[model samples]
Target: MNLNQLKISVRLVGAFIVVAMVGAALGLFAIFNMRTLNDADTDLYERETVGLALVKEANVQRYAAVVGLRDAVLATSAESRAAAIKRIEAGRAKSLELMAQARQKADDAESQAAYAKVDEAWKADQNALDEVLKLLAASEPMQDSPVLQHLRDVVAPPSIKVGMMMTELTQSQERRAQQVSDANTALYENSRNVMLALIVVGVVVGVGLGVVISRSVTRPLAVAVDSAERISKGDLMQPLQAQGKDETAVLLRALESMRGQLVEVVGRIRQGSQSVSLASAEIAQGNQ
Candidate 1:
């Protein structure tokens, strides 16, 4: 159906509804993307950032354990050796706890595999440390003893392997964190572009609807005004076309009816004047 056939109020309301729908779409799109970005940020913090911190802390503790073990082997007095052993035990315990926590955060298969390798290397290193501790407890060897050579050959290599593995694990966590950060950056860019496009589309649609509604009302009113002007100047022969069911069409119909009534009244007045003139002429002739 033609939009002009609708009431002026209905036409205006329809235009508003169209614009409102576009606005609603933009709002919903923004909400959904914002929710997505929030989720990404939470995951980055919880998984990537926290996990990397855990891995780094574990590596530090592992290094401390290796250092304490070396100090125990090189200690000159019993009390110093005991103190070094205490440090070794404390560092091992803390490192194990942190490694467990880091392992729990490994979500992907590759990360889990890397943690597994680190765990295996750490176990080997712990076993080697325990062997050296046992030797030291039994003999309390001197600094240049065969036990020192044994420590260098057996215990130190395993500790070095563990450090290397820890380094690898730390690198893995850093890479994963970087990947997550990059993905978030890309998602933000994509969301920004999409929102801008939606805004542009909404503006265009709103403007187009406003123009259409305005013209539909204004064009019909212009025609009505012209018809009224002609009627005021006593030029009533021109007919008005009242083609729609709107208020403008009703006004035009009313004006056409008034014009028809005026034409009928004028015709009656002209015939009456002609009849009076004829009667006056006949009376004069008779009198002559």
Candidate 2:
């Protein structure tokens, strides 16, 4: 169950695998965040930026139509009036097309409602314009005519209301864009913090694994070296505490066996010397 019981090669490979796993985890986390950020950027560009551009262009066309109507009303010549009427028709058509495109791009209920209000105001304005055109075709005098009064009171108000509604829609898009930008910023900060934390954790885990594996190999080797040195110096009294099924344990067992053999040989040599000394003393006493 001890780490040191495993082969040195296995322990080293296990440590490397652990470090690689940590690195892989960090890599996957980074990839996920990058994908999220890319999605956010795509949404901002496609929905917010493109939609805002469409709405602004539609508003410009609406203003052009209003200007053309004014010019038609104030024209002093028949040619100028016809040209003004042509401009009015072209502007109206273009504005309608642009607004339809903008409406198609409206994804949320609030934006759809705003577009509905704009359409209603545009319809009212168009009706008032039609009435004024009819009065002009009738060759009515504009000095104190009911047509001019109606144009001022009815046509102008709805056109202005349309402009106001468009302005509100534009503001809403701007606010939504700002919200998306702020969300992206917050997301980036959160991702940055999380990545840093992951990096720190990975580093700590790798270092810890390296230290543990290194000690498991080297600590036992140090013990083996010290035991060998003591045996070389004829200090055989100390016991080598070898525990495991590893090569180090085998080496320690061999050393312990060699030490026991050396102790037995030295004891036999001492006994033989004592026996020879006693024999020499007995011979000298017999000769005296």
| Residue range with the least summed lDDT across 10 consecutive positions in model 2 | 140-149
For residues 238-258, what per-residue lDDT tens digits would candidate 1 score against the true structure? 888888798877888888898
What is the Cα root-mean-square deviation between model 2 and the actual structure? Answer: 8.2
Write down the RMSD of all candidates, one decimal each.
8.1, 8.2
lDDT (tens digit, per residue) of candidate 2 on 167-279: 67776777787677767767777777677677777767776776677666667777778878998898878877778888777877788788888888878998999999999
- Candidate no. 1 TM-score: 0.55
Q: Count the backbone clashes (under 3 Å) in each candidate.
A: 0, 0
Backbone clash pairs for candidate 1 read none
Q: In model 2, where do residues sit more than 4 Å from their true spots?
A: 1-58, 61-141, 241-288
Error of 2 at 67 (Å): 5.2
| TM-score of every model versus the real structure | 0.55, 0.54
